[model samples]
Target: MLTKRIIPCLDIKDGRTVKGVNFVDLRDAGDPVALASAYAEQGADELVFLDISATQEQRKTFASLVKEIARHINIPFTVGGGISSVEDVAPLLEAGADKVSINSSAVRNPQLINELSKAFGAQCIVLAIDARKIDNAWIVHTHGGKNSTDKKLFTWAKEGQDRGAGEILFTSMDHDGTKNGFAIDPLSKLHALLTIPVIASGGAGSMGHFADVFALAKADAALAASVFHFGEIQIPELKTFLKNHNIPVRL
Candidate 1:
């Protein structure tokens, strides 16, 4: 059995970590470099750093900050936001990102996925889909969840895999920061349809939520921000809780 992964996400705005509800009313969480070191010390399986406003603001990801954070942690680090081409990915990787996540750019130019996979190997490419349930169908959103796209969630996931993406990081805009739990139905469906790993993002409130996402949704990993950033949940304690509940986690 593959051990489930618990990842903590750092949503960056103005070079500082921030958190928000349903992608609105952002509040400061902490310094990104400090938080990254703490999460790594807590045994987090991975760390995701997203320059949440980069795409909307039309700026590149903060590679210098990424490098500063990467130096403090030993775990795999993934960076996203405002990444549009292979050129955008190079600096982040050179700054120590183990994976590059592309969202709006992928929807705009699907070929970029194939190009990135071929250039850096699929293992380093992660397709991030931010979707919200509209009329009972999940619709992809971009530009930091400020814009919506006509593309449906599952169809896009399939296209991403065919284009050689190594993993899918699906964030339910509706469930983001809700603490209601993951969108299990969609997660399970995506997991069943894709051979690559599916990371369930948003709506994580407790350890039970983490276990449910792993056992019920069969998500390869669960990523959360506010809960981890605010100290509402600690990775070490959450891992212990999952282990007790029969969820295989690296403790």
Candidate 2:
């Protein structure tokens, strides 16, 4: 069986790491490069760096910051936020990102997924979907979760897969920073629908929550921010916990 992955997410705003509840009222976490190095040293399987304000600010990801963070970690790093085209992806990859995540741009132009997958190979493309449950259906959100679109979650996942996305990073806006748990129902559904790996993001409170996402939702990976950011959970401890629960995890 493929061992599940534990990823730490760094939500960046103003060149520093930040985390917010329901995507608002952001608070500083730490310096991004320092946090990345710490997580890598803690045995985190991967790191996700999101320029949380890039799209809203109408600018590209800070390549210099990405390069700075990349130099400290020897793990796969995925970068996102305000990435709109192949041109935008080159600098980040050159800066040391193993993969690039596209969210708002992918939704605005579905072909962007295809173009990116083809340009960099599907394995290097991660489609990030920020969604929330609305009227019994999950709707996609953009612009740092400030705008909602008519697109449904599952449909977009399928479309992204068909367009050659190697993985789906699904963040439940409703459960974000709640410390409750992951959105298992939708995660399971998406897992069943996609051949690619599905990364369950948002609402990770404890070790049990990680196990639940893997056992109940069958997510290939679980990504969290605040819990891991504020020392609420440690990657080494979490891995030990998952292994004890018979969840395959890299120790």
Q: Estimate each model's TM-score.
A: 0.91, 0.91
Q: Write the per-residue lDDT of candidate 1 for residues 108-223, one digit (tens) a residue.
A: 99999999999999999999999999999999998878999889999999999999999999999999879999999999999899999999998999888999999999999999
Residue pairs with colliding backbones in model 1 are none
Q: Rate residue 71 of model 1 by lDDT.
A: 84
* 183: Cα error in model 1, Å: 0.3
lDDT of 2 by residue, 1-251 (tens): 78999998887876777664222222323677777777888889999988867454433336778888878888899988888999999888888889999999999999999999999999999999999999999999998799999999999999999999999999999999798999999999998999999999989999999999999999999998878766788789999999999999888
Evaluate model 1: give its TM-score. 0.91
As for candidate 2, its clashing pairs are: none
lDDT score, candidate 2: 0.88
Shift in Å, residue 66, candidate 1? 1.5
- Candidate 2: stretches off by over 4 Å: 19-29, 54-61
lDDT of 1 at 180: 94
Which 10 successive residues of model 2 have the least lDDT summed?
20-29
Poorly placed runs, candidate 1 (over 4 Å): 20-29, 53-61
